[model samples]
Target: MNKVLCFDLDGTLINDKNEIIGGEGTIHALKKLQNIGYKLVVSTGRLEHDIYYINNRYDLKLNYAISQNGAVINKNKELNAKLLDKDEALNIYEYLKTTDLRVELNTVSNRYWHTDRDPDFPKEYYDSSNIVHDFRNVIEYQPAVLFLVIGESDKIKVVQEHINSNYNKVKAIRTSDSSLEILSEGISKGNTVVELFPNSEIISIGDSENDFSMFELSKKSYYVGKGSCNKATYNFSSIYEALKQIIKGEENGQ
Candidate 1:
């Protein structure tokens, strides 16, 4: 059976500025784990290209990339995806239109935003790579997920409750104070990981609520940094420290 180590990208592996926290040490530890026959997986809410970008930029050489929470997965070179029902997506679009929230549709490679543009978000998301579409027209893409950016922290819970209560076809998870993730019901990081590697002994490392699913499936779960995840088996300061502990666990036959 295979041994897998899945990591959540943002706060777990990289910092706020997108820099690898442990730098060379983190890379070395990952390489060592792979050398010992462990499969490395990056389980994140990021897009596919961003996964490749991290591997290329950091030399992480991950064996699998679970993108968009769990809507898409790249196992080695093969792609597997589960898209939102277009009608359900449109239903959400209509509901979100009633609010002042900044909305965007996320495909495996691109993010489509309304052409009217809300200045609530940073210029980074409105970059040249992502598409600009009029949400009033159609659900332009078969999105893997929808990002609803509610800039106000107070309204975040209210919006999440509204979506979860009204939508049976989709579920909304509060990924951050300003953001909520909407994906098809029953899809999650844990389900996807177990589906793909059913016989493997898994370990999860993350720092947020979305990572909770992964944590639930792990043989050992590590919650890094300060993000809220009470389900983790342990907590660590940095990825390097966590990786080292994982190595130590193996050495001690844990």
Candidate 2:
């Protein structure tokens, strides 16, 4: 039986800065582990486009990806997507609209924002070429697989509290301290991993509170030392060092 290694993109595999500044060794180490039959997958709150940006920029080849915090699962190809049902998605959307909050909808291939900003909105955080749409009328369409709301910490908390209080139909996850993300209930990184590799032993690596679900489901969990979260099996100073250790262990049949 083969072992599965799932990595969280932003902090565990790369870093908060998103430069891949010190993960080359880690990538190489994972690749070496893959060569020895350890399956490597990425589970992240980001969308496919975001993952593709990192892959293309760094010239990486991943086996599978669980995106939108687990609302989507795929194997690199856009055509191989598994998304939430339209009715379930719409229900969450309708409930969210009743609050004093803005939402961003994400499909398997595109992301739509309910703002006046152009579809080609600029992202100051990372170098991304993600397709953005000005979905002024979101209700016109069914709910998307992923929905995001960004604002101040207090506002986001209020919104989260409201959602938790009023809506029990969706899973609301806060990937970042300032952002709230909603998805279909029971849909998460752990669920996706089980769906794809039911029999494989699972290990997860991540660095945020949003990764709690994955950590809870994993047999072993690792966290990047500098990330926001504190629960982990091991804390590493850098991705490179972590990968080297993982690769060496896997290579030695440990």
Candidate 3:
């Protein structure tokens, strides 16, 4: 039986500063796992465009990807599934305008932002020329796969509280201490993985609070040692070290 390994980017595969500290070794480890026939997938809160950056930068031939916190899944750049309901999506957009928070909306093919002056703006995302819209004016648009909120941790928490209090149509998740994400109520990394790989034994690895959902859905879980994730799971000082264990099947217990 072949095992499936799903990795969360950002802190798990890369470091806190978004640097590939382990370099080619990490990629090599994944390649070795692929050679051994273990299916590998990247499950992340990042947009598909962001995923493309890693893919092109690393020259990796990844076949599967779950983006926008599992709101969308794809294989070979072809859509496999999406989790947004039009009504729920519309309600979220309406509710967001009541808040002063900056929000970024991600569709299957594009990303749009309500504000360009946001200090926490993702520079890389802006370079892609994703649509920019003013929150108050845009209406009747389809529900995006994911919504990203970047700000101070305290401010993000307040926004999350507001959403929890006012909205039941969607779910809000915090991937990092300073970011909040909104998605359809049932959309999650676990749900998407189950849908995509129904029968495979799943192993998930991540390094932050956002990864909790994936951890809940996986048969085995691991956390990179550098982040806010609990110390209970297997911890590695570097990606190469973690990859070495994974390729050897030695991290299975984690």
Candidate 4:
């Protein structure tokens, strides 16, 4: 059986500025591991297109990519998606419309955002490509994986808590201080990875609350930066360092 290395995107693969400063070193390590027969997988909360966008823009490559926090998987050029319930999505959408939060609905192919974009929402994180004034009219026609609410930390918490308290079919989690993400209950990166590779050894690397579930399922895990992740097996300042260490361990027969 093969060993799979799964890593998060935002804080792990790229820096806070969205640049891969350690590009050459990380790419070398990844290529060496691939040559040694390791299956490299990029697991992220980003949508499929965004994953490819980063890969192309940075010249980084991986054998497989898991997107939408595990709701969508692209393996061997095939797409497998686990979409949220349409009615459940609509219910959440209806409730979110009542708030001033910047809501983004992520489908397998495209992302639709609320027209009432909050001015405070970080410009770097907001994508203005697709904006829908109202999702109710087309909610039933599209397949969605999750919904994202972006705002002040306090407002994000309030929406997350409300959804957790009222919604049975979906669950909400704080992915970051300014963002709250909602996905179907029981759907997570860890769960999806385990299901995809039942016989392989799993190694996870990430830096936030959303990566905790993936860490829990990993045989060895590394937490990047100072973010909280009690489940990680080790801590590193950057993904490049983690990859170097992983390569060293593999060469030493660990």
Rank all candidate structures by their TM-score, best first, as comma-separated numbers: 4, 1, 3, 2
Would you list the C-alpha lDDT of every candidate in the order shown?
A: 0.79, 0.68, 0.71, 0.81
> Cα RMSD to native, each candidate?
2.7, 4.0, 3.1, 2.5
Tens-place lDDT digits, model 1, residues 127-201: 434445555343554444555555576677777888899988888986766778888898889999999899999
Encode model 3's per-residue lDDT on 108-221: one tens digit a residue.
666677556455443453254355566333324644566778778898898888777777777788887778987778777878887888888777777766677767777667
Q: Best candidate per TM-score, number?
A: 4
> Candidate 3 or 4, higher TM-score?
4
TM-score for every candidate vs. truth? 0.90, 0.80, 0.83, 0.91
**Clash-forming residue pairs, model 2:** none
Of 1 and 3, the candidate ranking higher by lDDT: 1
Please write out the lDDT profile of model 4 over residues 110-227, one tens digit for every residue: 7787574556432333352477788776568877788988889999988988999998888798777788889999888898888889998998888787888888998899898575
Worst 10 residues of 1 by lDDT: 120-129
